[model samples]
Target: MTSPPRPEPRSRAAGGPDIVPVSPNPYRFRTGRVVLVLEGVLLLVLGVWGLAAAGEGTAPPAGAAVGPLQLTTAHAALLLGTGVLAVGCSVRRRSALAVVTAQAVGYAVLFLVGLVGAAHEVPTVLGFDYGDAVLHGGLMVIGLGLGMWMAGEGLEGLWWERRRRASRSDDHHRSGTSRSPS
Candidate 1:
């Protein structure tokens, strides 16, 4: 049997297609992921540069300039490890929020450690200088902000939705409704 085609939605007086409204946060899901990837790539490049400078014996007492930023061997290793992890999580469907949050905490700790070490004139394990501390603080803020934004954009809904659906299923089963096989 053939069916009739559905009519298109239009404005009656204008005889034109109706203008659809767009959501304010149209790119909510994509924004965090894109930022993560970009940051990851930046970190990777800096890490490689820092490593190269260290290997070539060109690193100074303070640190080597990886692009505009200064980095030591320890800093380079930290960047490289986190960069790889960030890139990996960004590619996954739902891991971005968790990874971003974790990275933010890690950066925050490093920032504090750098500040304390510099203040007490104690040697830091990560060889953090003033610039490195500033960089870490910035990264920590970015990651934390991104994670919070994602959470506000319904990251928690994933967990809540699952629980809601499971409860609904249980309620349905309790109702004792049965369907006859056709």
Candidate 2:
């Protein structure tokens, strides 16, 4: 005689009783990382160029316009440090969100400073210029947009995961699957 047929295993993606929970897309995360790395490299290059101009004693101590890039020693240092930190964070899965958020906030502040300095017609050590303002504005938008999107994705995933767990617990209770203490 044939043995009793075994029950089919339930799949996570199975319909009806089981529900598929929303999750963060791995492709989006990868794309974000790539963009972060590219932006970091650009900042690094600009920083190095600004510093080189300063070292040559050609650019003024406060600021100078090198080709299309305008920067001072302080701005150059800031860029170099930030770029390095961003690149490091991009490689680490956990730090990406924090870094992006920080970058967005920092750029916003810098953009405002540039605007104020230009309005007053007095350089405030940041080497404020139209070119600098434009760059900062663009980066601010990109960073802020990406940061917010990532944060939303994280929250969505957490909410869905909690819901999935609660559903499983309810199912377990309804099915009388709990074993009694022997």
Candidate 3:
């Protein structure tokens, strides 16, 4: 005898139901990672240049002086830490929150240091002035905003995951019923 035909898999929308697959987020977490990497590179370059200037014992060219090695150390730390966090997040594929938190903290520390350097006229080993102070302040603000965006992206990812889980649960509940009342 011929075997009976198999039943078609039921869609969640139909009376019979199955798990609904969530659409992938169009903007992958990689975009945030790219931003983080770029920011980190910028910070690293600035830190290295500042350190070199400090070692030279001569004032850096106008608009290039970035204060002393002390200042540079902070910048370097921020850059290295943020870069690591970004890379880690990308690798883990499920730790955006941790990555964002690190970014936020790094940015905050960088901003505070910039402010202090600006207000106190903390001379770099290269003799920083008002121009350098203003420039650093502006960059810090930009970095802060970027860090906040990274954090926001992480939160969005979390929300997406939660929504997907909720949808799956709903599908499971509907499918468990033996029969439709109507």
Candidate 4:
């Protein structure tokens, strides 16, 4: 016979909307994957275009640091390569939070770079009298928004629950109770 229906774990807060509780970071996992994949594709296209322009002798100066942020072929290649690797890992569903965390850090760094450029008169990442201070500023905002969404998913409770479950599993293993008799 089939077992009886089980109650879904739900919001403990009074007046909170009902939710079917699952793992600690399912939402982040999915969102992070999407973000990484999209970034990867976009970067790939941009990198190819940049490299083509460079080959045609119409590319901008390589590794020029007029502004705090340097616009170089290496920089574009690095961005594209990082995008590819991140997307590959995300597709395998590995280290999602770690990747997103790193991305957040990257955004913060870029923001600082943009700020440094703003302090100078020279143009920044876009070059040709255009400064990247605004673009990086926007990236900073987007990154923070993503982080807030991830945190709003009630991850703290899930972390504690995972620790408890792991402890229980360890206890069982210590007691040599990994299996049951038929």
Candidate 5:
């Protein structure tokens, strides 16, 4: 059988006729950024609340309070750290990995604190219990999943940019246009 003819190479011009850069998807990036911002704000608020709770000395009349209000200092610190890291990454326009890493660390800390509080029976005004543990643990898992998804989207965006550039180059070559020098 006869071999198919080889295709002509594309032009290298900066604005070559063959080059059509596919626009990046803004929605994914925007959504991820929004989520990160919201989560960071929420964490910061929670941290502040924890600090305030740490100062209170009154215990609820119902179920056992997990521990003294001051015991939440560690939790407050972790939440504040997480929020700072997330906001810092966003402001710096760092890679999605940074955001993901921050979120993961934040969630892990939240989960660990919840687990410990439940296990040790420390009484907060909210009262430590298996239910609280489950709730906090579940939220942590959800945050982890969201972080991973954002990272994956960043990778996808990079791949898309590359593919679009290649396609443009190929188109230029097919049109028989001379490419401009870099």
Candidate 6:
């Protein structure tokens, strides 16, 4: 006189909350959020600093160009705004990869312009002495590494969540209950 089991829900149980967490490890999302916010704040600070450095023989409005690389006060402001958006979006979206990738590209361009072949002489970034082009190269490497780590961790979390949900579905289905709507 045994009874049948029920199929568990996918993403959420029947009549469950509309928004469900996607990871067993809650810290993953938190990490992504914190990192993005910090990065955004840094970018905004740099942007404001660049704007403040705009007057009195400041390196032209178009920013100093090193070979093929170009930077401007406007660009900094744009980046700052982008950072802010990234931070806000990160509350619901994965922004680590996007933000880090952008930073990586910027660093790469700087490296190419100043360290690739012959050296160019505008040795500063955000009005701070950059000593050599090595800093750009280093930052590029760090960004790339961080991006990879964040992507991998986030994706792994997703995979596990999906598997867990599927397991619940199987359990519910085996138990003979109607499968809950996802």
How does residue 165 of candidate 5 score in lDDT?
A: 56
Cα lDDT tens digits, model 5, 1-182, are 44345333345564434432342554655667777777778767766776566546552322322332233555565656767665566653344446666556655665676667667644654444555566456547756765665555345642222223557778889899868998
lDDT of 3 by residue, 90-153 (tens): 4443364455554556445545655565565445432334454454455456545654554553
Residue 78, candidate 2: how far off, in angstroms?
Answer: 1.0
Clashing pairs counted in every model = 0, 0, 2, 0, 18, 10
Candidate with maximal lDDT: 2
- Model 5: how far is 173 from its true place, Å? 29
lDDT of 3: 0.49
Model 6 CA deviation exceeding 4 Å by range: 1-24, 56-75, 78-82, 116-118, 121-135, 153-182
TM-score of 3: 0.47
Cα shift from native, residue 142, model 2 (Å) = 1.4
Candidate 1 lDDT, tens digit per residue, 88-147? 899653588778888899999989988876575545566676777888899899899888
lDDT string, candidate 2, 1-182, tens digits: 44345334345566434433545665667788888888889889888887887667677645767678778888888888878877889976558888888889989988988787767755677778777888888889888877866666555652233223557767879998975579
lDDT of 4 at 81: 68
Off by over 4 Å in 4: 1-21, 24-28, 62-71, 92-94, 118-131, 148-154, 159-182
Instruction: State the local distance difference test value for candidate 6.
Output: 0.56
Clashing pairs in 6: 4-175, 5-175, 5-176, 5-177, 6-172, 6-175, 6-177, 7-172, 7-173, 8-172
Model 5 segments more than 4 A misplaced: 1-17, 20-24, 56-71, 92-96, 109-113, 122-135, 157-182
Q: Model-by-model lDDT, in order?
A: 0.73, 0.75, 0.49, 0.55, 0.56, 0.56
TM-score of each: 0.66, 0.71, 0.47, 0.53, 0.55, 0.51
Lowest lDDT block of 10, candidate 2: 157-166
Weakest ten-residue segment in model 6 by summed lDDT = 123-132
